[model samples]
Target: MSLMLGYLEDYAKNRRGSHNYHTILVMGYAVAGKPEFALQLFGRMRYQGIDLDVFAYHVLLNALVEGNYYDGVEAVSNQIKSRGFESEVTHSILIKSFCRKKEFDRAETYLRRVMEGEVKIKGGGYIVGALVDGLCKDEQFDRAGKLVDEFGEFHVYDIWIRELVRARKLDGAMEFLHKTRNVVQYVPDLFRYNTLIIRLLRENRLEEVCDLIIEMRESNIPPDELTMNTVLCFFCKGGMVDIALRLYDSRGQIGLSLSSMAFNYLMNTLCGDGSVVDAYRILKNALEQGYFPGVPTFSVLAHALCKLEKLDMMNELFHVALENNVVLSDRIHEIYIQALCRTGRVEDGYYIHGELNRLNKVTTGCAYNSLINGFIKSNRADIAVRLLIEMQEKGHTPSRQLFRTVIQSVCETENPEKQFQRLLEMQLSLHEIDCGVFNIFIEGAGLAKKPDLANEVYQMMKRSGISPNVTSDILLLRSYLRGEKVSDGLHFFHNILERRAIGRKVFNTLIIGLCKANKPDIALSYFTNIRAKEKTVRPSLECYEELIYVLCNHKRYDKILDVIDDLIDVGRPLSSFIGNNLLLHSLKDRELYDTWVDSRPPTELTQPESSHIWRLREVVGLFSDRFRDDISIDDLEQVVRNCFPLDIYTYNMLLRKLCAKQVDDADKLFDTLCPKGYEPNQWTYETMVHGFYKHGRKDHAKLLLKEMVQRGFRPSEVTSALL
Candidate 1:
């Protein structure tokens, strides 16, 4: 590197157009893994007033990317644009850097800008191919396919085909290939055809494999050694060892040399299919032939032997693989550990885990998770927790499933607070202390009958900036009510009601709880308030009935009347249960009833000066005497005159009172009231039927009942029984 730098210095001092020569030298330095030297040369060139061309900028950009100086790359990019140097190579360098950083969206955006600027991308779609490969690696096959289609480039076709096979969309991929051939006159190469055949063999699509082979032969494309190995492995794994051996023997006849990978593939497949003895025989034969299987093959056999409870054999295979200098993948190691742990050999599993750690192979959370789950399954949660801490300390985030396992174990402990603290610790460690995680704690507290802890969790959830959902509100509301914290329950009730969060079931629960706690006054206030506010919660009828029953039992007469008034104003009929209770109380306590009646507002009278009020009062007064003797018709007439212009409601009440007594003038009073421009309603007919039935005039009562039914009026239960 120093010699090259010295040569560049000597040439720059002795040559014209030294700037161009220096840029070439910078590229050389960058290619040699000395990006800093390239950058230093660039700076020196600028200081010497050298004319930096597009090539210089391109080389400098590559240097910045190689050094992972993202900011420096951007600065060089801006310089290239400012100098009006259109370098497709520079654009591709930026795209590749962004893709390597997993910033695929930024890469796509920059690519689109370059395309829109009419700059022809160089190097046979290298930029597009990098993006496509990155997207495929990220499992974004759909985006990759769209990008390839937009560019009409087949450079990334192999990637799309491989991804489609991996995703199990082999048919779609085949159809795409057929369409590309027809529309663009494009032909797939041998490697792509091999990829399809291998995947088809793995999926056991023998008919498609046969057809593809026939098509390949017609196109003068023959299967390579890798293809035969893939087929051999597929047949062995599918429990067709006989066919696999035949294929292995026929490889020499087909002008193919035996490869170690082919031998490993056969042994691995045989072990995976539970033919460990057969796989061992194959391994021995391969060893005699100077071909040794790799770590993946040995790991597969070890896992199979461990599954069959043959740990002795598994250990021998592990030693052999180590002696062969074969390096096992983390997944293979994890599989071995999991098998041992499953067979009640967790100590052995832990030893293997330690060995892997020594080899720097235990880096992923998945490896830790397997051991953690194994420990948890064996009821050694403390060990699992220790392992979890170790995992996090190694910069691996614990999965939610791992945390849940530990939490469930913690909850089984004697101390509830310890369980809560452990869960909180897990959340903090994972940086996942969101509402969902806290909701679990809140629900757990409620189930454990720990309302205080539930409230704590709710507060914590809010402080964590996760707004509570309807379930959260409902859980907390129920917790407060269950704890007999009536004030807090009601406060939450009001808050949720305002937010329109409480559903009918939750509201009913709260109301029922309040009534059961002997706090019907508070419940009644809530009921009334909900009714008065438009778009607020409307309590169920059962809730209203509970409130009315409790209010009457407590003798809150004013509230009862108010409730009745509100029900009437809303055109909602009072439930028969509540109506009957009010009627019973009114009759049993006449003075209190009279006071309630007198407390009605003057507006309800409709006309304070009207005689209907006086007449109704006088009729109620004679209710006590009319049962003892028959009243004369002239006295009934005088009473009717006092109530002149009486409404139908008052008339119905007067008729109902008279029917309870033996007063003969009740019929005359009804006759006089109807002739005085009063339309006889259903209640009027029902009242006369009761009068006739009480007077033993069943025929007249039947006529009135028939007339009431004809007027589309269904009789009340009381009126039907009377008829």
Candidate 2:
């Protein structure tokens, strides 16, 4: 390579080179993969009074054509026109060049000029095949099919069919095949069968593959070694190794001689199935039989070694590939990197990625992803960030999934706010900030109590023509709620709904948020608005639970009654805690209870067997002084046992209110209960201590205070003030 560069440098110094030298030197530069240097040489030749002939122009023109430089072709054309070398070879080269370039219009212009006898082309299958291949690549399948049809009897018509298949125009190619049924020379060949079977395998049409193979047999077209290799690949991928082996044995009966290509496919299939030992045996035997597996043949072993966590074996095969002049695909490199990352050898993975980049084989998106994700997993955010910037500089655009992984990683970091800010700044500088990336930042902002940053991103998204999704809207609502801007969240919900931007989830979020914020009236209004707008909206259990909690908190007794009616009709399970709390609050004592009973119909509150009603009765019985001595103690005990189950908070509430009764029996009851693991809460301790002081039992209050502190129950200022 150094010798080739030295020659190029020496030849480029000759400013007055002849047309022959110019063509030779340009071709040499292109062969050395220095197209830029070739263009520079051409420019220098023009500057030094060197006149380019048709042959010199053809060399530069073909370079532009092959390198996909359409504008460069036009520049060369203008340079040619400035001179006077407008001959038939120039025009034919232009026509064939346009065809190769997929400029079908320009190609058609020159082809018409040639057909009208204004110009001449060295007309043959080579030029036709070039046009057919380019048209198929350009997805002008109809035009390519027409050319194949027009030249159906030509010996190279089968070649055009192969081109169509290569371009993945299976349907069009098959249609052309059916139309040219009379062309006996285009009969199904080994290449055709291999192409079809490979495609079917890729498409996972294993069942259809069997049918095609059977059809080949019936048509008297024996499956060649390549055909058998494709079938073996299909079976291996489908995990049917038994059937693939059976077919392999039957190859001899069909008089088929297996080539090294066939053995390599067999090994690839076996290696991918975790049968590395079997693959090694096959490869060794093939080598002994004077068959060498080609370059693509090593990827299977490399990837398989990676899958089996045998990195040493994988490296051995990769080096073998390098020695054998086999170019490894990016996927093989990706597998090795992922294996390194998975084993916690993240630095090794990065090193391998760098080596691959230096080799000009850095097309590994998965390898880059593994490096980033591994850094995140190892808590090395700074390194992951540097890698992302490095990837962008290398012209590799990170995929959406990569962004997702990065966002998720940063969001989970301890100081999410600072992490999000850094990410936002980085993305903004690189012009990589989109709605999805911004939404993650917004989520972190809400968590960090930074609504201002979230809103700024929201405005940026709008300015950049990015439409926000439901998650974005929800994040904004959370931001407002976190900032104590409840009205803003409410207004945003209302505006989104008014604009008919309402989805079921958004409606449910608004309802639950309002209810949670203690705005029961607002929640009810939104529910009513949704029902009016979308009458088909079926209420979910979540909505009902929210409404029940909201109604109980706001003491909307009448609304509670109406809600209970709807709930009963709906026939879902009643929330016992909300029901007990609501009933207890409504029936403060006998006077409040009498008013509730008088207002409600007798049937509305008649679930006598329910725990809610029994708890209500139990709470009423606590005010024993209100009831006469005629109320049975047995009846009260039964109510407490059967009506309400005891939980930590339930025991606390009962014990606190019992102390508030200022009864000597209440103290006796507390003494009995304290031994049963029913330790009182802060509220319970405060209630008992305060009750003792209010009733002039200072000695008992002091005892309660000491117990409270010992039990880690810190009473509030109000309770301390009484002490």
Error of 2 at 192 (Å): 89
Off by over 4 Å in 2: 1-422, 427-436, 447-452, 462-467, 481-487, 498-504, 516-518, 529-554, 564-580, 583-595, 605-646, 662-665, 668-679
TM-score of predicted structure 1: 0.33
Instruction: Report every candidate's CA lDDT.
Output: 0.70, 0.68
lDDT, candidate 1, 190-288, per-residue tens: 888888888888779866876776666666777777776677667767777777877776766665555776677677667766778777766766677
- Candidate 1: regions farther than 4 A off: 1-262, 284-291, 299-325, 338-348, 393-402, 419-423, 426-453, 459-723
Per residue, candidate 2 scores C-alpha lDDT tens digits across 1-723 of 679988877876774445468767777776676666677778877787765667677677767766767677788877886776555455655766787756798776555555456444445445455566667677787787676666444434666778766777666666666555544534667567678778767867777678667767877887776777667766766778767766766776876556665566577778767878666656655666677777666777777878888876676666666666677888888889999999998998888787777778764666788899899899887678778767876778887666656655665667765766677778777766567677866765666556666777787778879888778898877776666677988887776666565776777677777777778998887787776777556566677778877776666655655555555555545554644464345335344344345566766456565645434534444543345443333354455556445554554445444555534655665675668677667766776787788779999999989999999888788877777
Model 2: weakest 10-residue lDDT segment is 624-633
